[model samples]
Target: MNTFKYRQKYKSNYFEGWYIRLIGKKNIAVIFGITTNKDNPHAFIQYTDSRISKYYSFSLNEVETTNNSVEIGENKLTKNILILNVLDIKLNIKFLNVKALKKNFINNSIMSFLYYLPLECYQEVIYLDGEYTHESDKGRIYIEKTYGKKFPKEWIWIQSNSLPLTLASAKMPLLFNKFGFYCLFEYEKKQYIFASYKLGKIKIMRSGNTVNINIKQGRYRLELHLKLNNTVRLLGPTNNGLMTITVNESLDSNLSVKFTKKNKLIHQSTHKDIGAEVEMKNHS
Candidate 1:
């Protein structure tokens, strides 16, 4: 087994990375190892539905110290954390239980994500590079993916975020709310496929750190290369509870979120308002 490493500094060799668990109910667990160009810090999280397969890692930036907000991001799946000292200068991604999950799954991409994420991602969602409150009711968007050592061959990828705005986002994209999540696994004929189902009913309550989510009916297909950018929001509560999203828009053809599992749309979402905005939480 190769020992994972990380560094935090703006030195000749800046560092940043992290591994996350993909199994849990409410709060996901996260254990992490961080090394900057100069310092190394370790951290963990408190998952509501904690899983045993914890795994995580990350390369720290030079902006972290020890005293700062313990959390980052908003909503349930969001990577918000309780920072000890670091402030706006340092962007720390303390996944609730990211530390343990990374140790459990031990995926290799973690290293790539840490160093490349700062550059590839947008800043905090509040600064809102593209946050908009529009009135174009786009329809529901569906997505499908195959999990395993390699991507699933039968499943392709597609989304329906281009139709309109003001329409609630699809559940597929909301998974970004947490550091860890779960995927369905099964085998067909000769190939093995792992499916990641969306939390049809997700609630990002304002009172607590945890949230609620449930499965929705119906299934769609997508390609292996599809990159999903479904909209996600803290939909108000319903009779059952807080409604993540309701597909009532499909009735009028204007109030639905776009999705795909079997087919692709003519055009894709040109904008992503309810997308992940974790990169902006840094202070450094």
Candidate 2:
């Protein structure tokens, strides 16, 4: 089985989830997931329309999965298409002109550590960029994919199809020590990775709701700036039960990202309506 596939060997205290984001024209953004949280497993659908947000949850048994597809009741999710039907919303979307992030030795090697670690959570970007069309809703936008073996207790995730960037940084428990700040940034078709196992350097500065990350690898440097806007509370998994975690996410936030190689600028861009999440204890 592929290392990135959903694992079926989880323990009673473990959880696994898939995060699928679909952005459409006419100011529509849908973020939903299928979660198996041992204690309270379920499938959830959330979306925003005209600045109004709504959420729906269904039983875990309502979800089924193949190797690369997921079926939650009447909703289906795959790498190629998404057919969702919940409440008053119905969508039949197809992903076209897909552009996935290339998996190489370096990026693939970064995840090798998980094979030896006894950690409770992990994550990866399954799909980076793709054009999508919603037939029923008459909407069109970009789509992306993210799945994980439970979310980290403290982490910050940011992504933007407009900027064509994906960044995730986290601090979690690893064995007897803390995982420290490990980050992965993909931009301009290149991956700038900084992890504890790789012995790279990462510095973070946070003030109020804004976060700035500076990372240095062998001969590459990445700088990311993110600011939070109004957020909503979403259901997340804990060790014993499901908890309502406040995800400070804004599809309207601003992001500035720059990548340099050998002290020379390689790429830089500023994006709006970026997707961001800051989930830390007592912070969001």
Candidate 3:
């Protein structure tokens, strides 16, 4: 199922969230989501402008979604349209030239492994790239959905349509003192995955506001250099509810990437104004 339809499933410690990002000309951006955590489920909309940043939250009961559409209070999100009406902010946008990532063996294998884990979190990319129009201006947009019992203790997520890449690497809790380190990279239209089920290696280092990642799987290797700035706090999900954890995200960031096959450089590029999240600190 490419779309999320989990309203029927009921659990004490379950959580689900969808992340949507819209970029307009001159890098004007909006990021928002609807989250359902057992503790304090809610829907939120957030945006930052040159003068100030604003966030709005709504009760969980006001949120509803199907395979193709999402309604959060007065906000509506679908494959081709997004309408937001919160406080003094109002937005009506349309998406064009939509391109979605297709399911592949890599993603399927990762899902299979997560399904068997005790602390499971499933992730899927609903849309890879699309043209978003706000009034007379247009920019790019990317969307993703995630669900799980709880988030990993530590993880890093970075995505950029300008770079046309997505990377998620995490360390998840498991049974028998076994921990899972999973990394999935979508670059140059190819999926390079590293998980517990594969013979691969991943190294991550964080220095200040920058993160460097190196991943090797068979003959393929990828190096990602990410820098974060203008970060803001975003509500995150937990077993108890939305207040159990804090997520720090930045829409103004930079990403430099390199890919190699058999020791030969395949592609290299750098992109700016990326969407990134780093949740490594623990909060009780």
Q: Give a tens-digit lDDT track for model 2, residues 1-284.
A: 24334555454445455565565555555655655566566667767643666778888778777777777789877777878788788878887776554555545433545644656556555555567776555333444333445556777777777755666667766634343554555554565556656666766677777888787878978888887776655555555335355555566678888888898998888877677777653331
Deviation in Å, model 1, residue 19 alpha carbon: 3.2
| Structural RMSD, model 3 | 3.7
Off by over 4 Å in 1: 1-16, 39-257, 260-284
Worst 10 residues of 2 by lDDT: 138-147
Candidate maximizing lDDT: 3
Error of 1 at 219 (Å): 22
Model 1 weakest 10-residue run by lDDT: 120-129
CA lDDT scores, all candidates in order: 0.21, 0.63, 0.68
lDDT of 2: 0.63
Which is superior by lDDT, 2 or 3? 3
Model 1 lDDT per residue over 115-194, tens place: 23332111011100111111332122111111111111111111122321111112222234332222221112121111
Per-residue lDDT of 186 in model 1: 16
Error of 2 at 205 (Å): 0.8
Ranking by lDDT: 3, 2, 1
What number of clashing residue pairs does each candidate have, in the order they appear?
93, 0, 2
Of 1 and 2, which scores higher on lDDT? 2
